[model samples]
Every structure is written in structure tokens, then in C-alpha cells.
Target: MPPINVIRNALVAGSAERRPAVLWALASLALSMLLSSLGTSIANVGLPTLAQAFSASFQEVQWVVLAYLLAITTLIVGVGRIGDIIGRRRLLLAGIVLFSVASLLCGVASTLGQLIAARAAQGCGAAIMIALSMALVGEAVPQARTGSAMGLLGTMSAIGTALGPSLGGVLIAGFGWRAIFLVNVPLGLLTFLLARRHLPVDRRGPQTERAGFDTLGMLLLALTLAAYALAMTMARSHFGPLNIALLLAAAIGAGLFVRVEVRATAPLIDLAIFRDPGLRAGLAMSALVATVIMTTLVVGPFYLARALGLDAPFVGLAMSAGPLAAALSGVPAGRSVDRFGAPRMTIVGLIGVAAGSCMLSVLPTRLGISGYLAPMIVITASYALFQTANNSAVMTATRPAQRGVNSGMLGLARNLGLITGASVLGAVFALAAATPDIATAPPEAIARGMRITFAVAALLAAIALTIAVASRAVATRPVRDEFSVGK
Candidate 1:
């Protein structure tokens, strides 16, 4: 057989034999993300049905969604490390099987507890798939096409995310909530079959022993994230002194987790990835973008449904524009990044997003659906570009051996950004509406307060754009990392 160096070089050079496998891997990765993202958004629309079926309140039933998110966030880094230690293909297949079974369990769940438990399992499976998906693409495909392929995959995820609510609404309105869980069976089965057959084997030689898994680091990280999530979930509600104490304890736990990673031999998360200029900037930019994107999403539904008095169906239709635009831009932005490089494409996209936010922020109190749709498209499309470039930059900076763990950390950073964005924006919105004179204030005053939130989002994007531009300048000097791009 050819040497390991030969295979590595071929991968860097975009060899013919590797391209086909890369494409297949990208397809499977995108499909898996679609399923996981779809499950989250779709269930939101079906929450009322689930609530009634389980005899639960809105707050209680929310666990069905939160459990999945928390589980995924907590385990993604650890499971990703596992993928690195074992083989990505092996873990990917196992994740798919687990996800499928969890979905089935969720569908047949007779109570809220059962459903939440099932969702948690589903999240664990999702973490495995999500962490490995990008690594698989990076490993199998050549460097040149990485950006474009990732963009297409991002598009698939965005489409699934956007469609989930509408699909869930339609299903619940017609066939009932069970359909949402059942819908995954066919998709899951197909994904598993394709993955089992088409996913390539690990490139690491048989004699190349695996690294020891970081079990302690994994547990500490999980506990920390759980605590942080709990704190956020309780922030909006009235809590006792003991609850606040627990939240503070969780914060300390997170701090300890960070310290552990800095000193560990084989950290579940490779903290050194933070030192790379391109990577550091790219991750910060991606997180800022996520914060802006998610905040806007959180506020949009409230304004359309409650403030504007739009019907439920109409609100869903109106809100669909953003995701649609995001999905549409993913592949194109990706291709542009590969052709012209990352920074320019990312800045342009962030500017577009900022503009969209400004437009939405100033939307008249008496605005029509057209008012919202136009800005929504701009904001969504801009985010699509940001996501594609940010992901490309992160992946390109890391070596093949550490890709899985790095990808997991990247995913975690992005998810944390998302959670922070939603929380902060919600707080801003609530505070604005809670002013002493709010009842007497003009409708425009309320809109102005919302505008402040949007302005903050815009500022976040602008900062990200600045970093992206700097990173772009750095990328042009032809100084590729030895473990990364150039062989």
C-alpha cells in the first residue's frame, strides 16, 4: 500500500479518488443535520399537542425541547473526542442508529417524562453525528472544495431549520404530533444505509494506536453546560435564594472545566486551537453572528404574532422568508469563499445582515408583511454567508488528527453564542416593555426599544466583519499550518 504521507498529500491536493467519497460524506452529514435541526424546530409547533397529551403546562412541556438541546451541547465535545479516538465513520453510524431508535421512542412516548428522556437520547446521538460530519468532509475532500461543500451542507441545515416549524404545524394540524417523530423513520433509515455503505474508512493506519479518551474533562464540561443552561432557563422566572446559589455554583463549575482543559494531556477540547489567528478570529466572528442571528429570530416571532396581530398561519408564512434566504445563499457564498477566499465574502455578508437588522428595527408600527419579508431575506442571506465562511476558516486552520475535537469545540462555541443571543435579546425586549411609562408610551416608543436590540445585533455583526477582514489579510500570505492545508 502507498504510504500515509501519500494519502495525506492526495487529500490536500484534491485527488480524484477522494473527491467522490467527499461528496458522499457531505451528503450524509447534511442529511443528519437536517434531521436534528428539524426535530428541534418542528417540535416547537407541536408543543401544544404534546402538552395536552401529557397533561402538562407550557413551561413543563418545554423540557421536551430543552432536554434535547442541553444534552447535545453537553456531550458534543466529548463524543467528538470519541470520534477522534475511535473512527469517525464508526461513531457516525452508531449515532445514526441511536438517533433512529430515540426518534421511535419519542413517537410512542406515553408521557412527558418519557418524551423528554427520549429527546435527551436523541440529542446524544445528534452530538455524535454533528461533531463527526464536518470532520468526515474535511478528511475525505480536498482543501480547495471544502468551503463550497460545507456551504451546501450549511444550506441543507438552514432549510431543515426553516421548514421544521411549518412542517410541524401542518402535521399537527392534520395527522397529529406523532407524524413529526414518525417522519424521521424513513429519513433515518435511508441515512443509515447510505452512511454504512458510502462513508469511507478512517485514514489512520491499523498500527496507529488511538489516544486515551478524556473522561474527567468530559464529565466536568457536561456538568458545567448543564448548570449554565439551568441558570438561563430560570433567569426569566422568579427563583428562590437556593436556586440562585445553584446557578452560581454552576458558573464556578464551568470555570473549573476551562482550567482542566488548559492543563489536560489529551483534552476533550483542544484549547490550543484558540491561538491560531485565523481560527480565533473566525470563531469569535461566528459566535457574534450567531448571537445576532438567534436574537433576531427570537424577537421576530413575538413582533409578528403578538404586536402585529398576525394569525398563526400567516405568521409562520411570513417568518419563513429568513430561513429560505439563508438556505439559498449558503452554496453560492461557499463557492465564492473558495474562489476568492474567506474574509471578503464574510464581511460582505455581515454588512448585509447589519443592514437587514437596521431595516427591521425601523419597521413602522403599522408595517405590512412586505415590510418584514424584505429585511428578513437580507438578514437571513447575510447570516448564510457568515456561517459558510466562518466554518471554512475554522476547519482550514486545524490539522486532520484533531479535526473532530476542534469541530466539537467550534460547534459548542457557536451554540453558546446562540443561547446568549436569545437570552440577552429577550432581556432587552422585556426591559424596554417594562418601563414605568410603557403603558402610556406611543407604539413607536415600543418599536424604538426593539430597535435598540437590533442595533446591538448590528454592532455585533460589524465587529465580526472587522475580525473577518483581518483574518482574510492573514490568510493571503501563503503561510499554511504544517498539520493543516499545505502538505
Candidate 2:
């Protein structure tokens, strides 16, 4: 027997022995979440600087971020499936190592293409880190405590987001953009070491029961997401054969992926999960919430910098408000979800988001930092409320054996929303202002574009609110002892 298996058996047989392992595993996972979340937000703050440094057009430079997102979105489900077959602990450790190396490469890249490639590699690692983090938390913590555990994890994510921009600003201003990536190296190394030492061994499914990897499904899914992202991102570019080709490919890929998933013995994503209305509604709302959050992330900075004439530090400070609000609200929201159930909280939270969006859409153009702060706080606080409750709802509805893939699906929805939000909201801004690049567009044009984008986001929030209103409530289920080894 493997050493990890021995450890797992010993820990499972002794309740006192399990506590330290659980704490260590949870702590490691929380740190991993924080590190990965920090990387997600930090890159956004450097977009303008990167464009300037590379002398690349905004459309060209946007690929730096888009490439990362696309890679994660395309591969996360497949990676999550792999985690169940092998072990999440092993995969997570490998992911940390890969992320660290990719960060080093990104910091040293001399060209835009090299940076973009490195960022994609980083995203690949990020997919593993993200897909398994929540699943691992679920496996390690008791069912009764799962809500609070998830809340703490959510708070860590919010803290990372809260710190990212301000940290990015200080790093970029003092040390240059490379510091943002280089800094990850040391942190990644630490996380990798801790994860290797502390993360629990996987011993869930029998080896004979695990199916072969769905290679074809993964390929089709990748093509579908990549082509769709390209089509959306390049919609503002002059019409061309290449653009039309991408759209056609996306359409074909989507049709084929669905067909393959429906027929496969073990699909990359199990389509059957959607049959549960509560899970379905939770996922739908998750995507929309992420869309609203990312739209602000992608669009708000430009508006603040251009229309309000703030510098990187000031812009970073203003942007920090949202995540700070999210961090502050995450725990309370999670407790609320535990006590009151997810459905009611989701409805209330969605309303808050819609109201915040409306406020942002109508705010005056020249109110300085204070004006942006209030709307941002409101939007993000609502996001915290929605996300904590909605996530609890989704997890409660899913079976223990399906946690890895389900968590992957949840992440997939988020990244997909992010991809769509960045592309659609960006396109809206561009078309509204009649410009290809908001970075260089006139302040009035940016202001007009921002308003339109926020209004659209508000509409999206309303749609999610409607879905939550009609969805079934999630019932709290007892944790199965067979699946509760760590707990």
C-alpha cells in the first residue's frame, strides 16, 4: 500500500488524529485560494502598463488577460475529472510548481507573445488549483461546518482581491510590472511545500469504478471556448474571413461537445447535474454574479483613470473598495446562508447588485474617487451575499462523489461569465463610444460607454434575480459517515 493510503487509513480510524490533518489541509487550501485569487486581479491593474511596454494595441494586449482566462475555462473541467482519478493533493502540488515556474517565465518574458504564452501556462496551473481547492475543503471539513469553511475560503478570496490592486500598484510603481509576477515565485514555492506536507490523501472512489478520461470531450470543449472567446473579443475588429471562421468553429464545437457529453460513459462534465433545479439556478446565478463582478473589474479601472483622471495608486485604492466590502461581508453572508437557507438570501443579494448597478449607471462623470467607491462597495457586498449563499446551495445539492467535477462546473460557470463579461461589456463600451480602444478614447466617450455597460450589467443581474426567485430552496442534508473521513 502507498504511504498516503496508510496515513489515510490511520487518520480515518482515529478521530483525534484527524483534527490536525484537517486543519492543515484547510489552511493549505485557503492559502492556495488566496494566492490564485490574487493573481487573477493583479493582472488587470497592469494592462495599460503592459500595452505601453510592448507598444501593442489594446486589442493585442488584451490577449494577455484573455489568454489566461481562456486556458482556465477550457481545461478546468477536464483537470477536475483527472483529480478524481488520481489525487487532488498530488495535482494541487503539481499545479503550484507549474504556476511558480510560469510566473518566473512571465516575469522574464521580453515580448508580448512570450508573456501571453506564459500567462496561459499559468492559467493551466490555476485551473488545477481552483478546481480542487473547494473540493478539498469539502472533503476535509465536516458537513455541519462546511458552510463556515466555505465562508472562510470565500473571505480569503476576497482578501486576495482586496489586496491585489493596492499591492499591484505599489509593486508596479516601485519595482515595475515584472514584480507582480516575480513575487508569485516565492509565495508559490511556500504554498507548494505546505500543500505537499499538509494536504490530505484521496481515497474516495474505487480504482475499478473510475472511467477513462474523456479526451474527445476535453478537446471539443477547448475548441468551443477558445473559438467563442476569440469571436467575442475580436467582434470590434474589422470584419474578416478569420473572424467568420472562428464563429463557425465555435458553433460547430458547441454542437459536437454537447453530443459527445450526452453519449460518453464519463463525460468531462456530467450534464445530468443540471436536472436539479436548485443546482441549475445556483449555477446560473453564479455565472451572472461573476459577469457583473468581472464587468466592473474590466471596465471600472478605465473609467476611473480616464474619466476621473486618477493615477495607478489612486485607481488601485478606489478599486480595492469592492473586494474589501466582499471580504467584510463573506463570513456574515455564509452564516446567513447556513441559518436562513440559500434561496431567500440569493434573492435579496441579487436585488442589492441590481440596485448598485443602477447607481453606477447614473453616477456623475467627475465626482472623483468618492463617487466610484460607494457603488463599488455596494456591488461587491451584494456579490459576497449572492456568492456565499449560492455556493452553499450548489454544494448542498451535489453528491459527495461528484464534488470535484461539480466544483469544476461551478468554476467553469464563473470563468465563462468572466470571458463573456469582458468581451461583451468591452464590445458594448467600444461600440457605444464608437472607438476601438477605451484606454485612449476621449473621457466623455469613456463615461458614456461606462454608463451603458453598467446598465446592461444591471439588466443581467435582474435576470439572475428572476431565476433565484423561481428556484427551489436547498435543504440541509446530513454528512454521510463513509464520505466524512477527514471530518
Winning candidate number (lDDT): 2
lDDT of 1 by residue, 340-454 (tens): 8766777888889888888877763546567777888888988888778777777887777778887887788778788777776767766765654533444444566667778
- Which pairs in model 1 have colliding backbones? none
Off by over 4 Å in 2: 1-20, 46-62, 108-113, 172-177, 236-241, 306-312, 363-371, 433-448, 473-487
Q: TM-score per candidate, in order?
A: 0.89, 0.85
lDDT score, candidate 1, position 184: 86
At residue 446, candidate 1 shows an lDDT of 57
As a whole number from 0 to 100, the lDDT of residue 192 in candidate 2 is: 85
The digit string of per-residue lDDT tens for model 2 on 82-151 reads: 8877777788888889989999999999999999999999999988888888878767776655655666
Quickly count the clashes in candidate 2. 0
